[model samples]
Target: MPFMEFVNFYLMPGIVLGSIYALGAVGITLVFGILRFAHLAHGDLATLGAFAALGVVTIFGVSPWVALPVAMVACAFMAIGIDKLFYDYLSERPKIIVVMSSLGIALMLRAVVQVVWGVDTETYTRGIVRPDDYWGIRIRDREIYTIIAMFLIVGVLWAFLQKTKWGKAMRAMSDNPDLALLSGVDNRKITMLTWGIVGVLCAASGFFLGINTELKPLMGWTMLLPMFAAAILGGVGRVEGAVIGGLIVGIAEETSVLFIPGEYKAAMAFAILLLILLVRPTGLLKGKVL
Candidate 1:
């Protein structure tokens, strides 16, 4: 293969993977920003969303594209339920403790998924979309669809955060929860809304990922590190950071294959994360401290 072709193939996978990571990371950052916890269950919540989509596809015999929204709605409901059951009462707890608690929730959720779905790998779409050429580059329909969906969701989310009343309320809560409360912002409602939005985003990301790659019960767990790295790199609580960080991480992972073995691809995000922590712990975008 020519150098350009080789480069394109390497770059494309990274972008697709990074987009998925970015979508998940955005949810993580949002949860962290609004709820003030790490929300470790994010990955599993995403997995749950994927499984929901899988179920939807199975029941309706619908196209993956058609099934996505239904899956996202399931994820949204699950997220709301998780918050209501696990974190709602504990919202006032210490932040670090909440993070650990989130881990516990994550573990329980993972176990529940394993019990419900078993450990077998699953696929959402039976018929694969072959790669098509785009200006001398090759890409799959799933890849194009994922990228388009990501941008659409991100754009809508950005607008919601900036232009809408609820969006402003979310920002206020993220900036200062106590102040928001004093200002008459219902923290409970905001909390539920945040979970809902994050849930939708997580489900969409997981669905795309599962549709592209086979869905294993632990599929979301494997994405945690890269998603975290992307969040931290972009600056926690900053929506743009999550998106850009995901792109950077995705591109870096793909480009690294030029000099490193593919087996090491999983480690690239961690390595970059470590370096960032050492150099600029606040993240590249300088997000406000929680």
Candidate 2:
């Protein structure tokens, strides 16, 4: 294929997909770094968020873009509720138990999505969107928006973490919960805040995925492996690392189609995950080891 064809078909789509994966990966990293547990329900939460936006669009007859924030807020509360009702009580228990609970939560969340939205595949809009040509490169407006939005959201988060008092507290907790608590960091509040942020990220990730492709009940579940691969590859605690890892995974999966069958593309993430775990478990950025 010509360079432009490769760029238009493979690279551009990869980047857009990477942006979505990065959003979800950041949430995973945060939970691992601070909460110290694998949130198996994270992708299902994304699915719930996507369907929440669908609900907003259906009932309010609003633009999907407009419904984005609403879905984010709703999911945020839902995440907090889940933490309080399920995970919070298990805080003192073994991490494995919490991880298993998260797996169960994942199933419950998926069930809720199926019951509420039905199993049919759906799309936000009914019409086809044509890609605009930019100097021989073809890209859709939504793809542009997806990439830009991912950067903006992550950038704001980075700024908050580096600049704000609460952000510092969260970082401190992640680094040393015992020390942070000794210093009066208020662990409960921080945990709630983390879940809120995770929920927002989940919604944004799901919304972008839905807009770029069609929405299915299993869509976010299918994405779970890739998102986890991005998180682990990037390093568990490094936000910027997650973004880079997501891009690499996305590009590798897309480009692999040239050498391997498309049906096996998903295996790329698994391969990367194993290689990273074996070679550099600390991740590309030397993040905290699991």
- lDDT against the true structure, per candidate, is 0.86, 0.92
What digit string (tens of lDDT, one per residue) describes model 2 on residues 61-92? 99999999999999999999999999999999
Residue 65, model 1, lDDT? 78
Expressed as tens digits, the lDDT of each residue in 65-90 for candidate 1 is: 78889989988998899778877777
* Candidate 1, residue 269: how far the Cα is off, in Å: 1.2
Q: What TM-score, computed on C-alpha atoms, does each candidate reach? A: 0.95, 0.99
Candidate 1 C-alpha error for residue 247, in Å: 0.9
Clashes of each: 0, 0
Instruction: Give the number of the best model, judged by TM-score.
Output: 2
